[model samples]
Target: MDDHVSQAVGRPDLVRLDERLICLRFETMKVLSADAAVAHLLSTGAVRRGDTLLDSSSGIYAYALALACHRHGLRCHIVGSTTVDAAVRTQLAVLGAHLEQMPPSADLKLDQNRRVARIRALLAQDPRLHWMRQYHDEVHHLGYRSVARTVAAELGNQALTLVGGVGSGASTGALAGYLRRDAPGTRLVGVQPFGSVTFGSEHVSDPEIIIAGIGSSIPFGNVVHSRYDVVHWTGFAAALSGSVDLLRRHAVFAGLSTGAAYLAARWERRRDPGRTVVVIAADTGHRYVDTVFARHDEALPIESLAPHEVTGTDGPALPWSRTEWAGAPAPPAARVSPEDTVAPVTR
Candidate 1:
């Protein structure tokens, strides 16, 4: 029998929305990362058959890890954030993955901190458990190489602009790096929520901003700031509006992060009508039916801002920002078993 699920994880649809804009729908992008991480550990003998894989996630990564563990015949454990919903909880259970969800907190930073703390406690309890540091570890970047190669092969030698939400930085940053190797003129545009601190945006306490799976309140080591040519801090209203517009216009049922990317792609298209803009659609909209779709009418009207229209005073300067970390070295690889002598995986 064919392993359809394993085969389907990384091969998402590359769709063309218009002459200038395209969408890379990675509904199972995290699954690809999890598979690569697990495969690396196995190939390096970092883990044995009976060992357990562990990690901290908001939602998608946990589900991905669970699926990966199931395929590899390993146990899985997750320290999930408060944002994890009932559906995800059920999926984890079905996958035979243990989950410990953090208590509800309005602040995402606090939630992440608590999840990390819990993961540490869990790690202390078991020597056989391996932590897959999705946020900081570079191994996660290996999973996106195929996606980048696919983009390069499909659009050969074209001046391209890659747009997506910058989370752990693994997905967008890694893809940008790979694509640029073949097409050096490829521009990278990272989209972040208004309240996120990832791209040096001012921190605001807005419970109303419910967009997850994209922006982060804390720093992510995988995010390479220098790889980005432009950054856009999208507000909740703008993201919600974009999500709605995607459903209405393109019939693309995507999540808030996808909406933010779509909005940024539109701006990019307007900025340079000649360049081909590709947006990464990370996930679908089924998980957001109640919070996003049900509350669509309440979304505030957003006047699309041109690249120059965005002012720096509110956050980082529009189009460009002084956010690059000077002389920042690459983060150390995740600790592996002493006996495991394999070199770190690279794209």
Candidate 2:
């Protein structure tokens, strides 16, 4: 953890904070959603030089909207969920963004309404507030598509056997579009919470995926309608533990959603060992300190993932798959040159 993260979460670093490679995705995968928000804010004339703008989103959306509003000299008021990390909240707040808490309501336990209601309350109090409805808006796709393009570019002709997530349908949808063009060999995969009706299933699965920011009770046209190849299910605790172990071993700090993708990736890899599997670790694990880092995470009742070596599995409708690499093996110590050096060892 960085000093800022330590201060934000108000904990002395007993263990050094390690940020793992975590599949940077690519430079292109970076900065999804902000550009669109900026353009929309200007084009819609939804904000003025000194007016306050209202945004309802999780971490990524909040960060993007705050940046857009800030650039235009408009104050942004963001209402975020408790599931959002303290570090993310702190960063946005430090950027001069005002944050309002979203209390969990009886009917809105998993519904994003508590935050929406807060934003609505802010708007009710002031007419100058422009609400950026990200859930239904197409502009949000701008950034999401960018991420998808980046993911596709990262594949670089390699076969992508699986891809999927629950929340922010825009991100997954855009990736679907990009993969459809660039990585033609790529396969699409999606996951949903067991009872989620939006992803097109109401049959409450035995062990529903519990990662926050993914899975919904409502059907999302943006996600469900995409050209998906397959859909699978995972338990929350299982995915959570998987993410934690990923951090501990691979030194990869991924958010729960990313972990879910990893679980899917492993499942796909099992169907074919030679296939190149790409996992989209959408967000960092710093957002999950409350749970993974702690002996316990109170955010959700789901279980964390467990460590297991990747092994091939046989099945008809495997999570996902593609053809193996076609070639031969170079035996015993192929020529080595000084130019074929590892990273510069200063020591």
Among these predictions, the greatest lDDT belongs to 1
Which one is best on TM-score? 1
Model 2 agreement with the true structure over 72-101: per-residue lDDT tens digits: 677777788665567668878888998775
lDDT by residue for model 1 over 108-222, one digit each (tens)? 7789778867877776676567878787778898888888888888887789999888888888898899888878888888887655666555444444664676777656767
Residue pairs that clash (backbone atoms under 3 angstroms), model 1: none
Q: Residue 67 lDDT in model 1?
A: 83
lDDT of each: 0.76, 0.52
Candidate 1: where are CA atoms >4 Å away? 1-4, 299-347
